[model samples]
Target: MPTDATAASTEEAATRVVAFFETLAPADVAALGRLYAVDARFKDPFNEVQGVPAIERIFGHMFEALDQPRFVVTGRVVQGPQCFLTWEFLFAFRNFDKGVTQTVRGASHLVFDDQGLVTLHRDYWDAAEELYEKLPLVGGLMRWLKKRANS
Candidate 1:
């Protein structure tokens, strides 16, 4: 049952999510706190940060390290009540600075509020498989360790 509000909110949130990632490489506070709830809780491979301040810390590490790491949404799917944003991350970190570029594919699970602010956001992917394994000196070692441990 898609109500008018749900349809509009989802659409709006989707755009905002995209814009957030696109502009997020620079940590644009010019348009921050508007897309997420005041008590928003975010989690990724790194840390479980809550609220805007924690969000700032987690993202700060990224923007500072990633040589302009940006996310590009490949496709978006609106389920009965949720929107999953599939994205590809492009960046150049000393870890993966092979004198070229590196990209990692991932997805975000988002549940929006009536006002389109993200109430719950969860990211799904493997840091080791998608990122850590792509790093520099640590890349080979991490991959080998992961494989040995898994096997």
Candidate 2:
């Protein structure tokens, strides 16, 4: 069980992470160094990177690939130095979807250091269902497969 002080600290760190991701921008990529430790590790469905520079590059590529991509933290739970956050990542594909807004529901598990900087950040989401299933031709196949599996 976490003490009151430990819970408070975890909540504060979680809040900062939510705030940072909500306000993420190309210009703000460099500021990630402040939120993450120098040797921080980050992993997601499509990326596994360590260190601030690598993490920065991953976010930078997101801006390059999608238009107006942003993360909205919907819920949060804190435990000691660890936090879990549920979020919706919203974006519009510049090339394919055009102006259509795409939403990917996901969660993140974060571990923060004593100094409050994130040491490990891992995102949990379904690539096939959340992403690949949203594509054009692949979407139809993916839906069919899901239906068949369910039935």
Candidate 3:
């Protein structure tokens, strides 16, 4: 059973997390240091960054790739110390125009502190299918490979 305080804290943390991502345009990710605990652990398909310093580097790289990026979190379910968040990211490569928006749907398991700051954030998604294979040249190569392997 979850205490009311826990639920409130998580809800608040969720809001902050969502806001943090919404403002994120590669550059805004630096503010993540303020939201994440000093010893925060963040993971995704491409990299696993531990602590704020490493995390900042990862965000820097991501920002360099996508200048204007936004994350839309549609659903959040809380259970005790954990929150399951479903989000969709809208972004485009630097070379791509503003009208070209790619959406990546995924979920996160977030654990928050008493102060509603993120202590651990883990994301689950397949980059091959949701991202890499969606690119122009890379996507064509991947599709060809898949066709050859399947046939």
lDDT of each model, Cα atoms only?
0.77, 0.93, 0.81
Candidate 3 differs from the real structure by a C-alpha RMSD in angstroms, to one decimal, of 2.3
lDDT of 2 by residue, 9-119 (tens): 878988888998999989999899988999999999889999999999999999999999999999998899999999999999987979999999999999998888999
Instruction: Give each prediction's root-mean-square deviation over alpha carbons.
Output: 2.5, 1.1, 2.3
Decide which is better by lDDT, 1 or 3.
3
Question: TM-score for every candidate vs. truth?
Answer: 0.84, 0.95, 0.85
Top-scoring candidate (TM-score): 2
Cα lDDT of candidate 2 equals 0.93
Model with the higher TM-score, candidate 2 or 3:
2
The runs of at least 3 residues in candidate 1 whose Cα sits more than 4 Å from the true structure, single-residue gaps closed, are 25-27, 95-99, 145-151
**Model 3 bad stretches (over 4 Å):** 96-99, 145-151
Model 1, 1-151: lDDT tens digits are 8787787778878887888887674547434578788788788776777786667667677767777678889989875447898989888765445446778888888887777887677887788888778777778999899889999
Lowest lDDT 10-mer window, candidate 2?
1-10
Candidate 3 lDDT trough over 10 residues, lowest sum: 91-100
Better of 1 and 2 by TM-score: 2
